[model samples]
Target chain A: MRDTYQEQLDELASGLADMCDDVARAMARATTALLEADLQLAEQVISEDIKIDDVRAAAEHRAFGLLALQAPVATDLRVVVAAIHGAGDIERMGDLALHVAQAARRRHPQTVLPDEVKSYFAEMGRVGVELAEKAGRVIRTRDLDAANELEADDDAVDDIHQHMFTVLMDRNWTHGVSAAVDVALLARFYERYADHAVAVARRIVYVVTGQMPGPLAV
Target chain B: MRDTYQEQLDELASGLADMCDDVARAMARATTALLEADLQLAEQVISEDIKIDDVRAAAEHRAFGLLALQAPVATDLRVVVAAIHGAGDIERMGDLALHVAQAARRRHPQTVLPDEVKSYFAEMGRVGVELAEKAGRVIRTRDLDAANELEADDDAVDDIHQHMFTVLMDRNWTHGVSAAVDVALLARFYERYADHAVAVARRIVYVVTGQMPGPLAV
Candidate 1:
């Protein structure tokens, strides 16, 4: 039977995985809100971000209690510390999704993306959700191979982000500067969301392997 | 006489302060690089960012060691935990500065900012530096009043960020879509730099008072 200390550690891991799932759902809905110009869905994402924050606060409190009470060492210590950092990254992922939703609401009744770039955003959204869900799986299973996969998934998001700039800068582009600015910021939101998911995956790798794969590209 | 554990805690606090100063310097130089179109200065900021990262790594190592060896509780545990979080926030501030520098480098031989918005960016740089310096002070001194001041300073950056969008969308904007995108992203880098500075301050407040001042506005 697992001791209470081990149980608490297991709970922390599951809690972080659950937070990743929450943000994944948030990103999926946020993407729909962006693509469909669905004001109601956007508002739902904007309001529900607090639930992610609540999970983060609870994870931090639980980690703190474990650290103070158990004084966990070695891998256990790394797990608790990684939980604290992972919670922060996942919370930021939620914030990035919220930003995407807010961008959608800001342009409601007037789609933020031009017809030309909608497909690009749709692809980014799909990849972003995949990244978030994979990050959760990485955290739950401690599968280093899965954690490493997030880097490639993040590269896919970065490629889309780069392609977006090319579209914005093309001479054939017809969207005004305002729309261009909105698209640029929105692309960034997606990119950062993927980056945070990758960050969470990296933290889990550290917890299991005692080594960070590498510094994030920044 | 202070035991080695107490000395380690003090060293961790001062190390975080030093990191805040490092990022502050990076931001100031990055702003100069942005405003003057100094390719050399921009390159300098980009390369020197690793030094900030080094400090962050060291701080994290020290904190982890303290947590494992000392098993601190209550305020000491909070202090060590806050140092880890603070280090991350300050390192992100450094990354934001590097992004600003990269923006400048990307537009080398051509100033990134048009004349109309130069003054606004200059002001942001100035205020951003002030916020970083104040955050360092807050970490070192645990001054709650000083920590509260960061919110107003961040507001100043936000106001400038909002105003820059208005300028970009103005009927008079003649810089075209590319320039508008550059300026939008630059403004966000500055605004986020200020936000991280505030995040560091809030973490310091939590260390001292055992209460987070509030959630940072996403």
Candidate 2:
């Protein structure tokens, strides 16, 4: 019985790691779709997001089920609670990626951005995909060092986000209203996608350290 | 002992209701500050948001304590878990309100928006504060009807959000890039503020109806 409980706990952790992988791949593909104007790839990312959600839902079900059936307490209980919340953070990251994919799909054959903004988004996509991959490793290993490193990566994303505004707010900006709106929303989706990654890392830190951290910047 | 547990649970519920009130008031003041360029009011809202955070933190601590000490199960267990998550949703709403206040402060004596965009934000503020109040009542009463009604109120916010884009995208739009960015971010703060209220209401619906609902639109 004890072995079964431990196995279930391990399964929950592995499930979250897998969800992180899905979200990372989705983000990378969504970025590629956006930059390359690949409608088929954009659609693929959108559809794959559903699988991410299903994985998250299954993880949460398992976490809650363990709580109910195993009646875990103390450390075990905290692990379950953290898994549930962390799964939510991961799920939200997946949704953010989906938003990126949808943004790409909305433009279809048309490019989503002017030349000036495209490069920033391309960089954001690269950084976001890299962070998602790191998040997967941190969750799987509970590496405190990696968890802390996630924030620095997030700062890089924030810098890109701020640079996006600098370009938009520049006196030379000639993109007009429609392009402006797209840039604003798309920048936000990527920034928020990175924020959720940091948030997931924070939750894992809490689970491992048993220190309830402040809420992630939303 | 059971009565004691019940009383603690009641206290948790009341704590969340009070947070709803704080968040609602902060949002109202933030809106006033934004429209009138009231730096003092904006500062007040920003400072008071700390109290809101304190309340939510306490509530989570108590709920976790109940879980550990009471060893609650079944419906009782669900209530505690829901309260923890619900408190988080409300706390995030508070953060959104704080973001609104911060935006107003960031602009200082100068208004954050051009005169053209002011009325739309004014309307969004009114709807947001009213929904926060309604959300309080829904959480306190667990009124499924009111909980469901919150979605309609959120639609009003969404409409305002869409209108913001329409204004931004209009050929006649005269607001420069800086003002446009402010409007975009402010509109989103209000829109997301309403989304969190709906998310909270959904949590209450789940607690009351014992049927897990779909995730709120992120």
Candidate 3:
């Protein structure tokens, strides 16, 4: 019974790692949809978000079952609780990616990113995917160093977010108010996607080290 | 020992109720600060947010202790787990309010909302505070009717959010890109604040009914 319980716990962790990969793919495709005005890709991302949510529900259900049946104590208890928390954050990351995809679909037949700011989003998308992948690795390996790297990558995403705002507010910007709003919101989606990835990594750190680094920068 | 465990569980619920009140007050003050350009009030909201976080930490610690020492199962276990999840959502509500306060401070003495949009924000603020208070009531009483009402109030917030966007995107919108960006972000903060409040209420319903509310509308 104890060995089977251990496997359940292991499965929960790997399940979350897989979720991180799912959201990474969703974000990468959403970015492509936004850049290329590919309505087909955007629709695919929007429809497929359910798979991520299903994975989250399964992870949470498994964690709940473990807690109820095994009543794990000490480190094991923390692992289960952290799994619940990590699943929520990862699910939210998928939702953010879905929002990005929806934005792409909303502007179908007309690309969302103005040329001047497209490169910033491209970089944000690349870094955001990298952060999600690193988060997956961190969950699977419990490597504290790898977990720490997510923070730096998140910072890079924030920098690009700010730079995008600069381009939007620049005197040369010709995009009207509607387009500016779209860009602002899209940038926000990428920034929050990275933040959630970092949040997942932080949960893993807490599970392993028994210390929750610090309160996330507001 | 059993009696003490019951009391600890009760305390966790009340702690979360108090947190709802704290965030409600913070959101109220944040709205005032934004509308009045009151730098002092904005700063108060910003600094006082730590108190909310502290309350959250205490609540989680108590819940964890219950799980570890009491090893509660069935309904008792759900209560403790729901407390953990509810505490997280409430803490995020405080953060969203803090973001509103920060937006207010960023444009101190120069109101964030222009003349035409002031009334819309005023309505959003009123509805947002009402939702938080109702959420607190639902937490303390487990009143499913009140919990259901939160969904309606959240809809009102969403409506105002859409209205604000309409104003921003109107052909006559004279606010330049910077101000438009500020309004867009501020609207998002209020909308998200209301959403988190509703999330807390939904957790209460789940604890009572044993069914999670249909996944939050996106």
Q: Best candidate, DockQ-wise?
A: 1
For model 2, residues B175-197, the per-residue Cα lDDT tens digits are 77778778888899899889888
- Per-residue lDDT tens digits of candidate 1, residues B1-218? 65598899999999999998999999999999999999999999999999998899899999999999999999999999999888888999999999999999998989999998999999999999999999999988999999999999999999999999999989999999999999999999999999999999988888888898899556
How good is chain A of candidate 1, measured by TM-score?
A: 0.97
Query: B1-218, model 3: which lDDT tens digit per residue?
Result: 35588788889889999999999999999999999999999999999999999999899889888989998988788888888888888898899889989989988889988888888888899999999899899989999999999999999999999988888988889988888988998899889989988888888888898888988545
Q: Which residue segments of model 2 deviate by more than 4 Å?
A: A1-3, A213-215, B1-3
Off by more than 4 A, model 1 = A1-3, B1-3
The lDDT-based order of candidates, best leading, equals 1, 3, 2
lDDT of 3 by residue, A106-215 (tens): 98899988887888899999999999999999999999999999999999999999888888889988988889999999999899989988888888888898888888
What docking class should model 2 receive? medium
What stretches of model 3 exceed 4 Å from their correct place? Answer: A1-3, B1-3
The iRMS of the candidates, in order, is: 0.8, 1.8, 1.2
C-alpha-based local distance difference test score of model 1: 0.93
Clash pairs, candidate 2, are: none
lDDT of each: 0.93, 0.84, 0.90
* Candidate 3, pairs of clashing residues: none
- The residue-level lDDT of candidate 3 at B51 comes to 97
Please list all clashing residue pairs in model 1, or write none if there are none: none
Give the Å shift of residue B126 in candidate 1: 0.5
